[model samples]
Target: MATTTDPRIAVLSAMAYPPYNETSESRCTPWAEAVKLLADYRAAVLREAADRLDESETLRDLTDDHMHDVNAAANELRRMASEETRPSDG
Candidate 1:
């Protein structure tokens, strides 16, 4: 459900098609696909967070607790994404 115009998607697209890279066509295809997959996953996380906020009651008494939970989820997602995309030394 991610739109092409999304800034994250735009950044991914730019990364996938870098200028002056001399890699083979076949190799580039898989890399591009992986970037797209990651972008889609990030979008899904954002959507889920929005949905949870939307479903919460306006007069709920657990605002602080809910905010902490949401912040934790966002931090975890950011950590996971960074770890997954980082290049391995071995």
Candidate 2:
């Protein structure tokens, strides 16, 4: 597996994910920090992909696919976070 040298990903790697109930960020749910970290990491991945456009086509394709998957995962987390705070109508 390829590794990233981006500092944002490194920061994310250094940050530990707290429990879903333990508040981590100000005025935000415990998992919000995690979601933000993931989103940041995904953004970094895309940026790196853009920078590496001169590389092989196979590598670019793989990176593009990876970026999409990361985006999907980040969006799913965003959806889950929104659902966590949504007022139930039932």
Candidate 3:
């Protein structure tokens, strides 16, 4: 089973696969590439978070504002990835 922290990467990997008995659209490559990039970035950010917590003397004492900032950054990355993969209504 995939860990919750990395589930998005797993989902993207699964979705990047070719469909059975059907041709894929040309635009799929860009979306797949974007997903892969986001997955890599997410993993890197998580690694950094773990490293920070490990090196900090008082992780338990982190302020709510700092936590919120971290969460917001992660959410922003998700939003950007979603935007890149979404089709525009043009």
Candidate 4:
């Protein structure tokens, strides 16, 4: 749903996830640690967003336009994460 052009928003949306393990980074190297830090942040954001949705009780009333926006965001995040994990085709 999300286009390749919306990386920043996608990352922010992912950040809405919550209840992360902050100490997970201690077990890894500097680079891996950094990645974990970002992941935790994204998870926390997603969790918060999910909580908001639960509290609002408006998912059923969401307009088609809004749902499209959410789908786009979810897709963009998925694509970005996949690209990051993929090996270069040199």
Candidate 5:
């Protein structure tokens, strides 16, 4: 289990990968690295989404909003990924 984890990482693990949040694996994997991996994955997904949008002309109507949401998610994930894995005060 994670005895001293950043809450953001804990919540992310709980929501995206419960096993990490509940098992000793949390200690085995560094939160900063895990979050960075997730952020990178999100960037790849966003790129895929963009390519799909570019290939489908009919979906133009929602392309802007769709990209906005994806970009927002990517930015937020990046912010979280860059945070301290362990609180300095704790």
Candidate 6:
């Protein structure tokens, strides 16, 4: 797999893989942090795609696909964030 130079991306990538603790809070913290980082990264990617699309007619479809992926990531982040803030029965 390709490695990321960005520290945030690196941390998020590490969080994605194994050795997770058995505690709910421990697991949730990394998951939440990864979602937030991914959201931020995707937002940046979306902006870049928009700029590239504006600069050229070619690759428009590719750029649109990237934007769609970014939007999906953003939506997932929003859902996760909302769930994190919701009150628990416990």
Q: Write the per-residue lDDT of candidate 4 for residues 6-37, one digit (tens) a residue.
A: 44454444345332456773322344434644
TM-score of each: 0.36, 0.34, 0.34, 0.35, 0.36, 0.35
Whole-model Cα lDDT of every candidate shown, in order: 0.57, 0.50, 0.54, 0.51, 0.51, 0.54
lDDT of 6 by residue, 1-90 (tens): 126755456556666653456775354335554555565565555555545545554444566678676566556655554554454453
Worst 10 residues of 3 by lDDT: 18-27
lDDT of 5: 0.51
Model 3: lDDT of residue 61: 67
- Residue-level lDDT of model 3, residues 1-90, one tens digit each, is 123346466555545652343355333434554455565555555655555654566654678898666556656655655554455443
RMSD of 5: 10.0
List residue ranges in candidate 5 displaced over 4 A.
Answer: 1-27, 60-90
* Candidate 2 C-alpha lDDT tens digits along 1-90: 113466475444445432334344333323444455555566555555544543435544566678676566556655554554444443
Model 5 lDDT, residue 27, Cα: 36
lDDT of 5 by residue, 1-90 (tens): 233334445446545554443565463445665565455455555555555645566655566789676556656654553452323342
- Which residue pairs of candidate 6 clash? none
State candidate 4's TM-score. 0.35
Report lDDT (Cα) of residue 64, candidate 6. 64
Q: Pairs clashing in candidate 5? A: none
Error of 5 at 53 (Å): 0.3
The TM-score that candidate 1 achieves is: 0.36
**Each prediction's number of clashing residue pairs:** 0, 0, 0, 17, 0, 0
Candidate 4 contains a number of clashing pairs equal to 17
Error of 2 at 62 (Å): 19
